[model samples]
Target: MRALLLSLLLGAAVLPALAAAPTDPPTPPVPSTTDGLIAQPWYRPHHLIGQVAGGQGMVTVGVGYTTLRGRLDVDVLTGYVPRKYSITPMGIFTGKATYSPWTLGLGASRWQVRPLSVGGLVNYTASRGMNASLDGKYPKGYYWWPARSRAGAFVGGRVAYELPTKANGQPRTASLYYELGTNDLYLVSLYSNIKALSVADILTLGIGVKVDL
Candidate 1:
């Protein structure tokens, strides 16, 4: 009878040990959800705009993304002088694409002249929102502001710097830049009477903000 009791007690202890032995945690199946895919770092678009000094206004819109640990940016801009002019508007359209350490830009401007000016630029960015560029512009029409078509080519450079801040959980950025260019304006009907439309010295200052969509 004692042997029988001992055997039953040993069986009970062995049964509990077997029950406690760990089993492979039910293999957690890989997540199959949209949120899971988006949880990884990915590309997003950004933009900015601001006012020009002296009551004149300027605007810029652009898209950019980050990949391979580098940044890619592209932007277009337009500028206007308010109330001082009518009919023949003066403006510029600029498109630029930039990769880390190198940038390329193309621009067209109508300076109250019918000239369809086209230009290209090469630049380098030293830091966030800071860069220097060497650019060129060629005018095709008359410089009518002076009652003459000025056909010429201009070469210039610009330096730009920007600052960023946040308030109320929003991003605000501001920028200031200056440009200097020089080229000869060919007076229509007077080949010998040429004037220089000093493209080499202009300053642009602006402030802007960012929003997510």
Candidate 2:
């Protein structure tokens, strides 16, 4: 009887330990904040993009980096135009910096919209005999804007849908965007000849899709 009682006591002692033993695998840890999402490779780019117009070229493709929870974006794009379309087959390199201060969530549908985005860009187009120099070819200060380089500004909006990301805790998103922009030369012309050129005459439209990694 004493031996059976001792066995029962031992079983009771072991019961608590077994109850505390882990059964299912440990739950995946939740990232406490957005900064932790890219802490490992902080400098890695966040996206790849394809665009049209925007005063660079007929078609543009690029890579981009996003910060501030996808609010600030910087993109480097390379654009191309066919020889049949223009003077030559031109290659344009453009760098764009955009500020999206706000994002509006669309209910629980995993969709978001950026109502307003403001940005600026600079572009360099390369081609034979296409140069950015007055270089005494047309006398000094004859042209205020460079032939090869252009500076522009834009305002735009975007709609994005978020996708499930398991490998990296970061959100994956695909977005479509549109922008209305004008070049520095266009703006200068508008300011000097207000009645002659309306806002639509000076505006250029850009459309694109972006995929967040």
Candidate 3:
């Protein structure tokens, strides 16, 4: 009778212990909100870009960063123009920013359209033979604008095709874009001779491509 009572008591204790133990898997720890942003290195660019003919150079290549949910892109580019196009071979360094207010998705397709894009650029041209505004050859105030530097604004559009997402779930894309732009010098000339110089005469067209990293 003593042995039997001992076994029963043990059984009762084990039954309650087993019932209290968890059956379901432990809940996973939640991810921190800033984990994704903090994981990315600051020097890593969001995209790589290349372009042709926008008064910057005959050919330009660069890297860019995308922000504000891909609505804004800021880029830095290095451009080259052969001697055939200038007195000497010229290298152009440019910094630009582009903003696209809207993105429209094509129905059930990977294509996306940015119907309007507005941007501005500033560039400095370096060439051995190029005249500098501050050079002794030009008297003070003789030229109001810097000959080797130019600032411009453009309006353009882009079409992007989305690719597979990265391991981290960031989307990838390839895009083709076009820009119509004019420089400050061109604007000044146009203003001085509005009747003789039409908007088309001062406009420059640039074509380019961008690939998301």
Candidate 4:
């Protein structure tokens, strides 16, 4: 009887010790490829953009992606020009890419400044009333470029104000920028009439805003 009782007590003690003993913590789960892409989806745009008169259209609005530590912005925009400005009301679609080499933050202020920004854009305008530059009436090589498509380059600066952080802990910002640009056609005209055409004559002014999403 005593032996049976002692054996039961020993068994209880040993079972508790074994239960309390810690095993190697489960190996942390290896992050899968799907987990890595959750931070930024391919279809998500980083910000929204709107602009006026960069030779794109009278008013342009679009979505954009901010990459390269905010130094690069790629935007796709659509714009409209009133009939008063052209033979007919026109719709313009533009793809633009801008790069700013440096960004300076103001001393303890939310304001920031980008001293230099350079970019290029390609745009297509659709209008029924506009005559085609390279039509059957003209020889194949007579007109070197299409009337509806334009390519341009610009240089500018930007001023931005930091906004409150979002619920997801993402920072937000709003920026205003300006671009002075010239289109390929304008550049060609300047090249042909260097004495008559001034740099200011060919330049187009554009102002825009960007808001983080």
In model 2, the Cα lDDT at residue 173 comes to 85
For model 3, state the Cα shift of residue 163 in Å: 0.9
- Where does candidate 2 stray beyond 4 Å? 1-37, 40-43, 131-133
Candidate 1 least-lDDT 10 residues? 109-118
- The sequence of per-residue lDDT tens digits that candidate 3 reaches over residues 1-213 is 999999999999898878867775677654333223423688999899999999878999999988766788999999999999889999999999999989899999999999999999999999998878877887788877888999999999999999897766677789999999999999999999989999999999999999988
List the candidates' TM-scores in order: 0.28, 0.80, 0.82, 0.80
Model 1 clash pairs? 115-141, 142-149, 143-149, 143-150, 180-200, 181-199, 181-200
Q: Which ranking of candidates, highest lDDT first?
A: 3, 4, 2, 1
Per-residue alpha-carbon lDDT of candidate 1 for residues 1-213, written as tens digits (9 for 90 to 100): 999999999999898777866754667545432121222335544445332421122443333332222223343444453334533443433343333332222234111111121222222112222121322232543232321111122222222222342332222223222222212322232345335332223222233332322
Which is superior by TM-score, 2 or 3?
3
lDDT of every model, 2 decimals: 0.32, 0.86, 0.90, 0.89
Residue 142 alpha-carbon offset, candidate 3, angstroms: 1.8
The positional error of residue 95 in candidate 1, measured at the CA in angstroms, is 0.8
